[model samples]
Target chain A: DTAVSQTPKYLVTQMGNDKSIKCEQNLGHDTMYWYKQDSKKFLKIMFSYNNKELIINETVPNRFSPKSPDKAHLNLHINSLELGDSAVYFCASSQRNIREAKNIQYFGAGTRLSVL
Target chain B: TQLLEQSPQFLSIQEGENLTVYCNSSSVFSSLQWYRQEPGEGPVLLVTVVTGGEVKKLKRLTFQFGDARKDSSLHITAAQPGDTGLYLCASPGYSSASKIIFGSGTRLSIRP
Candidate 1:
């Protein structure tokens, strides 16, 4: 079974269009994250939710919003997407250890979003 | 900001050749992780080193953490075509939160 899965493996939309990507994890992890990988292959953490509560919000713009309905699902919605929104969006989950602050993340295949 | 810098941004070598990639940082980290990402796929964690001056081995790949906990290295012996991927080094964010800071990554291409 795939531990982490993301829907819409590919997305192509025009500028100013809004889109959403869905992600689900079966690992029973407490924390889920949304990451953006640019064309340079630089991975950056955009948002993180632990047990359906927002924990980490990076320097991402307000256009990108992450919602976690439960511990197993975290979805990302982009409003009025622009050309700079083009990148591979990845969903990951981990069993967080607050004491140690270290965890192993399992990632999905990723959704490639291209904004024209 | 705490940053992880990986050396040899791009490497293309023939199969059977050994290679070593380095991840350095000025800030100390409690632990570090290594991940490999293949084309069209998300990164998969290979190993994690926690203690200073610690070393771990996975088949042909060996990972070492610096004594100061500020650097790490990954050495692959007799790299095969299957090993071709982008290797990234990451650490927990400076804050106590569960965020991870990933390095730029080293893109390795092994030709058969």
Candidate 2:
């Protein structure tokens, strides 16, 4: 089974449109994160939820918001998307209470977002 | 500014050769993790080093954490074509609110 899964592997939408990407993890992890990989292959953390509690918000634009209905699902919503939003978005999960050594994150196949 | 700086942003080597990728940071870390990512896929965990001067091996891959806990290195011996991928080193952010912060990543290409 896929430990972490994302929907709409590829998304192509016009500028100023609204879109949402869904992510789910079956690893029973306590923490989930959203990351953006730019064209230059630089990965940056955007947000994180620990047990559905907002723990990290990395000064992302107000147009982007993350929602975690529960500990198993984290979804990203983008409103009025711009051309600059084009990039690969990844979802990852990890156990929070484990020792520092076991904090390895498992990522899902990314969703490629293209804002035309 | 990026907290971690990775050397040799890109490397192209021949099969059966050896190569090393370095990740450096001035700030200390509790643990460091290495991940390998292939095209059209997300990165997968390769190894995690928590102690200073710790070394771990995975078959042909060797990972080393610096004695100061502020840097790490990955060495591949007799690299094969299958070893070609993007290697990234990451560590937890300095603040409790910040999650994991990834380096600039090094793209390794192995030619047969």
Candidate 3:
């Protein structure tokens, strides 16, 4: 079984269009994250949700929003997408244990978004 | 802002060669993690080191966490073509509102 999965593996859209990417994890993890990988291959965390609660929102533009209906699902919505929004989006989940200081995150295959 | 600088952003080596990728940071972390990512895929966690001066081995790959927890390294011995991928190092954020911070990433290509 795929531990983590993301939908819309490839998305190509025009400028100013709206799009969304869906992610799900079956690992029973409490934390889910959204990351963006730029052309330079630099991966940056965009948002994080733990048990459906928004815990982290990086300095991303307001047009980009993340919604988590439940702990197992997190979706990203982009409004008025710009050319700069073209990049690969990755979804990951991790189980946090109080006793351990570290948690291992499992990632999905990734969704490549292109805006022209 | 916490920054993880990975050295030798790109590496191309022949099969059966050895290579080392380094990840350094100015701030100390409680733990560190290494990941390998193939084309068109998300990164896969290779190892995690929590204790200072800890070393973990996975087959031909060796991962080390610095004594101060501010740095880490990944070394692969006798690399094969299957070893080609992008290597990344990351650490959990310092604040509760922050997420994990990833390095710039090192792309390794093992040519046959």
Best by lDDT: 1
Model 1: lDDT equals 0.94
lDDT by residue for model 3 (B61-86), tens: 99999999989999999999999999
lDDT of 1 by residue, A1-116 (tens): 99999999999999999899999999999999999999999999999999999999989999999999999999999999999999999999998886443588999999999999
The TM-score between candidate 1 and the true structure equals 0.97
Segments of candidate 3 deviating more than 4 angstroms:
A99-101, B95-98
Model 3 DockQ vs. reference: 0.62
Evaluation by DockQ, superior candidate among 1 and 3: 1
lDDT of 1 by residue, B22-61 (tens): 9999989999999999999999999989899999999999
Rank candidates, TM-score, best first.
Answer: 1, 2, 3
Runs in model 1 with CA error above 4 Å?
A99-102, B94-96
Question: Worst 10-residue stretch by lDDT in candidate 1 chain A?
Answer: A95-104
Sliding window of 10 residues with minimal summed lDDT for model 3 chain A: A95-104
Query: What TM-score would chain A of each candidate receive against the reference chain A?
Result: 0.96, 0.97, 0.96
Q: Could you give the CAPRI-style class of model 2?
A: medium
Model 3 per-residue lDDT at B39 = 94
